[model samples]
Target: MKPLDEQQAAARSWFESLRDRICAAFEGIEREAGSDAGFAYTPWDRVDPSGEPGGGGVRGVMKGKVFEKVGVNVSTVGGTFEGEFAKSIHGAGDDPRFFATGISLVAHMANPHVPAVHMNTRFLCTTKRWFGGGADLNPPIPYDTDTADFHVTMQAACDAHDPAHYPRFKQWADDYFYIPHRQVHRGVGGIFYDHLSDDWARDFAFTRDVGEAFLRIYPALVRRRMGQAFDDADRARQLEWRGRYAEFNLVYDRGTLFGLKTGGNIDAILMSLPPLATWS
Candidate 1:
């Protein structure tokens, strides 16, 4: 298969792997929470009516009754990266070709106690250029222990790839996951970068390793915490905090900006938005 085709296949396979991993992770979380948190899985596929040739996301969501306060959503989108990609992203110079092949993944956690997470890996291309996707995290509620634990796990994964990677990538995540005007942070921020120019072996290794680490670490974290039993007041407070998170994504998140700019399908782009969300 050609490089693009190969990348496409890899992305598809990765999506399935991610979905399965997250499902298992949440299942463990539900067990720990001592409740059967049901999952909402939607495999959506649609062709653009605008004659654009691609659309929609295959998505999965989970919410436990015991942990009814917590949930996780995962999805993948394959379509033309036109208006949305062009307008919303930064650090990428003006170029129409960045929309060449559209494939991206984003995952969100509903519990404020469990950090709300975001990861996106895509295959971007132009007539003369190409690069694989990258992943990052955005946690709305920052707990030093969880935040530190999260970064520590990721750092270990990156360190296994390159010792220097942890500090730099962790800083990158901090910088990338931010709402500049608010002067607060989007969670504590985790490693984020675009079009890194480095040895492919090392970069690919780091990305792949981090992916595995996510599978290894997050599910257990969620299982341990999700259904621990928060009061309605706690859930209410979480929803209030989620409202802030929603504002950042809708108003300032680069991904949301890019998705909207590229003329992405509204539903697909907005899938990143929680089904029901509020702000304080």
Candidate 2:
């Protein structure tokens, strides 16, 4: 494997730091709930199609009283995009070589009222360099207050960077997260933006703000509803909703496809899956 450039090293460092903070926050929540659960971290390596070293990542997961299952992963990978896949990635058609570093997180709460959530932010470099990712809330039993808060926090993050960003990215998330066949959305929409290569410094700052916004808001939301009472019917509804989430990740998620195409670690790539889900 080649040594990381300055930008790549900085991004990888920030991502790993974010992962540590998030895991600590979650463990604190577990302690509050009278459970001592903590995240278990597993490091995995990747091998490119050429059988050369490709960078890898650590997968951190925890199952606890509040958070039924949650995975926080940080990876820094560099390799060539495989055949047809090269044509599909931005800026990679002509030069398939690429470098990517990012953090991805998904949490499915034990209590149905406590929403499940997904958040990811990444910096990728091919012929073009860009940053992309977003966060969304998924609840089987939706709440107006929770939805409003989540959107407002995300909007603030966007507004700090560019006033135009909130509306544009929010709609992008709405359109991107939809399950076309089911005619339903995976979750209440957040902001999703891609191919943001205009200015590297500005774009990277915005990406960092997105991560900070999620760190501030999501834990508060979790603590708010984690103690709420839920019944079997509620659990059933959560499971059914998770089925739709699964479908979208398996079929429509670009991140999933990128991981597979890049020869990323299978278990780390799939850490987004809920610990348990039901189709019906």
**Which 10 consecutive residues of model 1 have the lowest summed lDDT?**
66-75
Worst-scoring 10-residue span by lDDT in model 2? 263-272
The sequence of per-residue lDDT tens digits that candidate 1 reaches over residues 25-64 is 6666667656776567665544542465443455455555
Q: What digit string (tens of lDDT, one per residue) describes model 2 on residues 1-280?
A: 5799898898888889989999999999999999999999999998977788998999899999999999999999888888888999999999999999999999998999998999999999999899999998888889999999999999999999899999999999999999999999999988999999889889989999999999999999999998888899999999989999999999999999899889887887888888889986
Listed in order, each prediction's TM-score against the native is 0.76, 0.99
What is the total number of backbone clashes in candidate 2? 0
Scored by lDDT, model 2 comes in at 0.92
Show model 2 residue runs off by greater than 4 Å.
Answer: none
Name model 1 segments beyond 4 Å from true.
1-4, 31-34, 46-52, 66-112, 128-142, 197-201, 227-229, 263-265, 275-280
Superpose all Cα atoms of candidate 1 onto the true structure and report the RMSD in Å to 1 decimal. Answer: 4.2
lDDT of each: 0.56, 0.92
RMSD of each: 4.2, 0.8
- C-alpha lDDT of residue 266 in model 2: 86
